[model samples]
Target: MTNSPDILSNTFPDTPQRRLLLDFVADEADALQRGEQGGFWPDNHHLISPLIGKAGKFLDEDEHVAFFHHLLRLDHCPPVKTEEDFALLLRAYDGLGDLMSRGYPVCSLPFHLAVFLFGGDALARLPAEPEPTLASFQSGVSFLRYARSFAHMPGIMSKRQKFIDLSADRALVARVRKTLLHGHQQLLDGLGRLWLWAFVFLVLQVEEEAQPVIRKIREDAAAAGDVKRVETLERFIAAAGLAR
Candidate 1:
């Protein structure tokens, strides 16, 4: 295949590539259920392995498609402007997040997810919105709840990760498993906080320009008696401001 697997390029993640990513997501899940010894994530160090396996490493077609395609989907993201025709970029974002939660190597995506989900002109249509719909506010709160699980999720110990994580730290990532399982609550909490800081940060990318949207989401959570959500959103607002 001439495709280099580098996302955000003119030559990658065309419709077929996008479909391939989605298909392999399901395939990984199914592969886990039946219990393949190593599952499909490449034994290679990177989350997405290279097309031609070097030395003695090997990559199956499904493993190559699912993981690399995921990166492609992530790079293009909920389609914005003259960016490749990724009209489904936000949906693509969600798919990428789902994959991360499943322990695919995320490299720096967590950081990108936290800070740049709507980078550039991705949200170009929203600057003049009259008001967020009830649905929009609800989705905001829901996303925080969805992302919160990773705060403490070890996301480790996969047979797949043990091989890779051992090097990366899932096998230790498998090793990480050994540490976390034996470690105390304080360690878990600290780890959770870092992951949450990254994971849920995307729950609300509340830059000052985006504060109105965050305010509405916070307001809705408050009115609905969601003390936890109200407090969290307030913190996100403060954190966003501080980061500046």
Candidate 2:
């Protein structure tokens, strides 16, 4: 845990973190199931709690790692050299559209899935020589867009799939349940809490960048009093963490 800059610092969907985010995603299905079972699931307010909680946990771990190890040193890594490069890295990942329909676990991470499963072409098209900043901003934007998209999945999925089918093969209910029961001990080998911490580090950073854009989108929606947009933003924020 000492300051080792060699750690891969890149950006979103830091595979490990993405895995943790996906794990939390299981809760949405669980909450829907509980609600159906007549449990006292609150309204949207109940939804945000899980997201913030999961995100907070992830962030807490990331902070610890950073405190002990320092930022990842990816000097040779071209994708995260600058903000633009970051954006492009994420934009390049737009390829996940195909995978999302298949319900791959990566789909749970949305943008990361897009970047991981779909970014080949964009990446290939890079300035042949590629600049560190070329895609960073775009990638950041993609992260924001994808983060926003998370909010819709639970509501949409809840409506689309039956609760039983959603949680059929699952065990955990809310994120709290999963954390309390397994902690990181249960995560699959090579990918567990560490991965999630990376994700948290990346997103918390991205959220800082995304806030202005997200706020702009919200303000635009508010100016027009767009109820749908507000709801969508709320859902996106909530779902981004798989908390709600």
Best by lDDT: 1
lDDT of 1 by residue, 146-193 (tens): 444442323311122222222331111111222222212222233234
Across 103-134, the per-residue lDDT of candidate 2 in tens digits comes to 22323332232222222222232222233233
Residue 53 displacement in candidate 2 (angstroms): 46
Worst 10-residue stretch by lDDT in candidate 2?
68-77
| lDDT of candidates 1 onward, in order | 0.33, 0.31
- TM-score against native, each model: 0.29, 0.21
Q: Candidate 2: which stretches are off by over 4 Å?
A: 1-152, 155-205, 241-244
Q: Give me the candidate number with maximum TM-score.
A: 1
Worst 10 residues of 1 by lDDT: 169-178
